[model samples]
Target: MSKVVLITGASSGIGKSIAIFLTEKGYNVYGTSRNPKNIESFPFKLIALDVLKVDTINDAVNFIIKQEGKLDILINNAGMGITGPIEDTPTDEMRAVFNTNLFGAIDVMKAVLPQMRQQKSGVIVNVTSIAGYMGLPFRGLYSATKGALETITEATSMEVKPFGIKVVCVAPGDFATNIAAGRYHTPVFENSAYKENYQMNLDLMDAHVSEGMDPIEMAKAVHRIIETKNPKIHYKLGGFLEKFSIVLKRILPDRVYEKMLMNHYKL
Candidate 1:
């Protein structure tokens, strides 16, 4: 039997690439999207789902369980990004982002855990970002979602370890994807704190995505994780710059890192 895996947010970008690659590699991949039927016909099955919908998530998992008999891998790749200062980002919008990014990952994980527990083996990967570990200005809330995901991954990994389940977090930096264009860039403030300091930070984020990692880089990383018998707790990948940023953030003092960020992004 081919290994059965389910991926969310599989309509495009890294998710789409991973689906295509894994399918070619003989995994029985089931890809979920908001408009699954609209997707062009392919070898893998398309599942109609909105990650935010609890019933939709349940139905999709049930369908997979019936067809595949057991679920072996789950790629919690569905997420949304928003760009704005944390203070100014509206409450509703914050939940909206969290709904798809954090809550949705949890929803799917909950739905899939039973089968994995029964089988006594499985792997779950959450595609977080470098910002998940280190915060940056003008993207406080967006970073918060990924940070929460990384935390849940850590906690969940330890909790599920006894069940022979592995949870992995992948923090890739600035992949070439529609996430930049899809970013919800609301005029998040009328009278907000740090209003004056946000200009350069926003510009830095824009430039970083415009010329950063390719989506395939992320897809390849996903492939590597899936093939491993025991994947690491966390994986970080991207170009030289993103890896260096992660390292420097670890070594440099808080004030020193702040200064380096200001200098690097010219803030």
Candidate 2:
């Protein structure tokens, strides 16, 4: 039988691209949405699953196992974006993103591990962000969420290896998606200390997303990783500069890298 796959946040954007691509490749793909009823149709199976809700996560995982007998791959792609100066960003909102991006992803992995463990094999790919590797000016909350997930993936991969399971993190740079529409934007308050610079950085961020590479490229990258015999713990998919920035950070002095980012954002 073809590999059974589950992908979260598949109503649109990168998750949708990956689901469709994998379905076309003959994998038994099950994509998820917070409101599956809202989506009239999808190329593969689209189910209701809100990552913030552990019950929904468990139900979805159980439903898949019942239908497929076994799940071979899981693409933990559900996440949201938040942008604002760290001080201006609401504490509750920061916690909300963490719940969805980090805790929720972990919960899903927990739900699947038993079945995967019993089967003696499985692969979990967590979709992170290139922004996670650095503290971007107005996107500190978003960066932190993905960054935390990256670390979790590293630890989880080692823990599950003996179970014949694989865990990987695929961090993508800006991709032309409707993420901006869904992001929680802390309003640009006129009296706020970061008003001018924050607004400028927000505009710059939107422009970058609008001009970003195709989501299909991300799908292709995931496909390649899934097919590998021994995939690396972390993989980054982005433009040359975006990926290189991580490398530069490793080799450059602290102040030097900070200066480069400040110059890039004109802060």
Candidate 3:
């Protein structure tokens, strides 16, 4: 029987690309969106799933397992971005962003893990970001969420290895996707302390994402990882600059890296 794969946030962007790519490879793929109605037609199935809601997450997993009898892969790609100064960002807004980016992914992981554990042969890939490697000025909260997920992915990989379940994190630098369209821009209070640089930083970030690597490129990398019998714990996907940036951040002194990032954003 063909392997069954479940992908969250597959309505568009990288998620959509991965779903279509895997299906072409002959995997039985089921994708998800908060509102399935919004998803356009595709060869694979589309299931209504709001990762933030525990019940819907469970329902989606249950439906897939019921139909396929086994799930071979789970890709946690549902995430949201929040942009603003850390001080001015409201607590509720931060929580909502974390809920979608961090907690929501965890919810789906919890739902699918049991079956994966039982099968003793499955893969779980969490879609993280290169932003997770460093804290950007206006995107601090978004960075924190991905960083947290990356840490979790590391821990989960070790814990589940003995059970034959491989947990990996695919960190992409920037993908040309509609993510910016749905991203949350925290309200910048007039005369606020960060007003001067906040908009500039936000605009720069948006422009970088718009010009980032193609979503299909990211999907192809993921497909390669999925085919590997034992993929590495972390896979970084991006162009030369993006990939080198991560390495430079690791090797450079703290102050130097900070200055590099600040200079890049013209801060």
Candidate 4:
């Protein structure tokens, strides 16, 4: 039997591309999305799943195991971006963002670990982001969410290594995907300290997406890691600038970087 690979957030962007690439390579791919009915027809199975709900994670796994008889890989990729100025971002928004990014990924990881443990071999790739390593202007929440996953994956790797499981937190830089296709969650906050600043940043972020790297570029990296005999703790992939940005973040002072962002965006 072809290795069974299950991908969460498989509807679009990096998730969908990975599914297609892996499927073409002969892995029996199972994709989970909050809206399973809308998924296009494919050789693999599609199951309804909301990673925020632990039960949904369970069902997705069970469905795959029943069909494939074994699970070889789990790619936690379902998440959303919460973009706005940090001060203007509502408390509820922060909770909701983490609920989806950090908590949701954790639920899926817990759900799949049992099966993977029993088999004593499996590959887990958490779809983290460049935000995890360094902060982005007006993207504090999004950065925080991915950052949480980065830390979680680190501790998780050590615990699961003894069980013969390989865990990877793959952080991608800007990728041209529907995620950056547009910014939809605009907040209509009443008079606030950061209202105008927030709008300007949103516009800038949207502009960034319009000029980002292709999402397929990220998918290819994911496929390579899954196929490899062993994967690294973290894979920071993409254009050379991504690496340089992290390096700059280390040397630059806090306010110096803040001024750079403000000046670039003309905030």
**Span of 10 residues, lowest total lDDT, candidate 1:** 188-197
Compared to the true structure, candidate 3 yields what TM-score?
0.98
- TM-scores for all candidates: the values are 0.93, 0.99, 0.98, 0.93
Write model 4 residue lDDT over 1-267, tens digit each, in one string: 799888998888788888888888888888887888876776667778998788878987988888777899999998898777667667888898899999999999998899999999999999998878866767878899999899999999999999999999899877778885433364747777777777777777777776778877777898889878877888987678766777777889978877875676687
Which ranges of candidate 1 are over 4 A from the true structure? Answer: 188-200
Q: Give candidate 4's TM-score.
A: 0.93
Steric overlap count per candidate: 0, 0, 0, 1
Q: Could you give candidate 2's per-residue lDDT for residues 1-267 as a string of tens digits?
A: 999999999999999999999999999999999999978798899998998888999999999999989999999999999999998988999999999999999999999999999999999999999999999889988999999999999999999999999999999999999999999999999999999999999899999999999999999999999999999999999999999999999999999999999999999
Best by lDDT: 2
Which numbered prediction scores highest in TM-score against the true structure? Answer: 2
**Least accurate 10 contiguous residues by lDDT in model 4:** 180-189
Model 3 lDDT tens row, 1-267: 889999999989999999999999999999999888865798889999998889999999999999889999999998888899989988999999999999999889889999999998899999999889889899999999999999999998888889899999999988889899988998767888888789888788788889988999988999999999879988999888778888999899999999998998888
Please give the lDDT score at residue 25 for candidate 2.
Answer: 97
What lDDT, from 0 to 1, does candidate 4 have? Answer: 0.83
**Candidate 2 regions with alpha-carbon error over 4 angstroms:** none
TM-score order of candidates, top first: 2, 3, 1, 4
The per-residue C-alpha lDDT of model 4 at residue 56 equals 79
lDDT of each: 0.86, 0.96, 0.91, 0.83
Model 3 spans with C-alpha error above 4 angstroms? none
